[model samples]
Target: MEYVKGKPYFCYCDGKIKQYRYLDKDIKCEILIIGGGIDGAIANYYLSKDFNVVLVDKGRLGMSCTACATALLEYQLDDFAEDLLKHMTEGEIVLAYKMGIDAKGKINNFIKTQGNYCNFALRPTFLYTNSFFSIKSIKKEYEFRIKNGFNCKIFDSNNSPFTFPLKCGIYAENGGGEFNPYLFTKQMIENSKNQNSIFENTNIVQLIKNDHGYIAVANFGEKIYCEKVIIATGFNWEVLGIDDLCERFITYSIVTSPLKDFTWFNKALIHDVESPYHYLRTLPDGRIIYGGEDTIFKEKPINENVSNKKYDKLEKDLFRLFPEIEGETKIEYKFCGCFGSTPNNLGLIGESKIDDDILLFISCGANGIINAMAGVDVIKDILLRKNNPLIPLFSP
Candidate 1:
């Protein structure tokens, strides 16, 4: 699928970080990772430290959905704890939330250890209700989070920072952050330069499993032999013929020019309880970035008219939330991309059901990057023949 439309803000701002040669000659490795986006980069970073790993992508690294991603690193799931209780046991819900918290901390530590080349910053997140009726659900969610040992606070309309109507909200602490995803992916790939090989513009056309390992054929018929394969192909995992486990949607976003005053946002990641909700955050450069307005994916072209309407709606929603910035902010960039969400809003990460030798990493839902990092940790443990208790939680 065409993951993104128009010029993504990350690519426009950072340009290409580093280029890799296409895979022309046959290669062999202990581990092979397909899809060099953020998930692939994370796998490479972790796997290369102990094993010989080779990463390949059909296009430039970090230029896929990773570039278009809002890169909000938070532990909050798109499915709240109270909602998940209907389907999952209390123990299961607690475990999932705890893993999410661990994922956030892992990402923060990884950014710090990697020298923070991605403008990583830890911040709080505010999830508010968009309507008066949503107040009850948000309150229950806040109480559930607190009861489960998560750091969260409840705020009513009287205490909310917004001038607009907000019935109530959950102010979650120590579990939210933002980062430049493109830069982070590039840096991770760069760090693996010595221990691993990375190939771009190389498409894996076929995968054949054998008694010993697997052979992945490239577009040019070049073969890659590896003991194991990791598919980090984001929303396009169906290329491997795996089951369509996620529902897809198209999401729109816009970035404004550096604002003189963004203190009203308090640099907190803001989202709401509404379906197809709007989310807003600020960049270190004082620019405002917001996304939402999702629609069912029908494979329609994002023509000029569609783009204009989506951008207009996003802008109108922004003004509704913060009217003070109506005339002060000028939108500098706008784009749309494909987003995927599972039924339970958790990622799919474990051994592929189609092939045991192929491990799949599909992080669907809002906390995608965080789930990707957590997947990396789980895959590493699997590689070392160690058991990760969180495996069953995200297993396919």
Candidate 2:
């Protein structure tokens, strides 16, 4: 399935990662990770530290859905805390937020230790709404955060820091991050311990269970005999042959040509509270990535005609937020890709329902990269036969 379409800005960036060869023979290991996107790279990077691990992908790593990710690593869910109460406890919601903050810290530490080659930066997050109806909800969410001891401030039209109109908004001083997703994926995979065990263009076609474990057969008839499997193929689940994992959607994004001396309030990661809402962030080069306007996925490749319309809408919306840029800059890139979402706004990152030995690393929702950063520990705990409190929230 074609999960991404158009010229993704990340893939076209200057930094090119090292390539890996396809599997030519059978192999054996304690754990085999299928799908070499950012999620897989994260899992392999941490898991390989203790296990005999091998990571493989059907195609090149971080060039599919990962290529198009806006990568707003925020410590907030797509839904508000009150709405998530229907599917999760208040404690779980708080825990998820804490996990997101922790994950952001981990990413910072990794960059500090490994060198900052991914253009990563810590940024505040601003979630706002101009609608009167959304004001109450935004206030409630802010109250929840303050009650939980989160450091943030509430804004209204009287005290709004942004030029755009705002009825109400929540600002977290240390709530989010932004980065070059493809480069971050490259850094993780390259720094992983099992470099010799990583392969690209190596499709795993079947998994045959045996008394000891299972044998994963490749498209070219090669095999991977392993004790466990981790599927991190983003929204492409052809290998699992199952469709009920989560609700899938195609999200559209557009990037603008750099504007001279233009910047938002603190360059904070921004999200609006509209249905199928929009998000925006600033790149190091002054270009803005604006995205959203999602549609349900129906097991079809992205339609160019529909994508064109979506791009047009996104461009207009971008102007709506920042009218000064409408005549100054034009869109330089347009792209869309599939993403999954669960009711709880968490990911399927634990043992699969089909088989206990087969684990899943499908990081879903808007903060997927953040979820994956924290979720690796859940997978690690499961492999170590330890109890993880977050397991139930992300159980597959």
Best by TM-score: 2
Instruction: Rate residue 154 of model 2 by lDDT.
Output: 96
Report the C-alpha lDDT of model 2 over 46-153, residue by residue, as the tens digit.
Answer: 999999999999989889999999999999999999999999999999999999999999999999999999999999999999999999999999999999988999
Against the unseen true structure, what C-alpha lDDT does each candidate score?
0.82, 0.93
lDDT at 366, model 2:
97
* Tens-digit per-residue lDDT, 157-250, candidate 1: 6787656677888888676888888988888888874433889999998999887689999999999999999988887865687546678888
For model 2 the local lDDT of residue 265 reads: 95
Query: lDDT of model 2 at residue 138?
Result: 98
Clashing pairs in model 2, backbone N/Cα/C closer than 3 A: none
Model 2, position 178: C-alpha lDDT score: 91
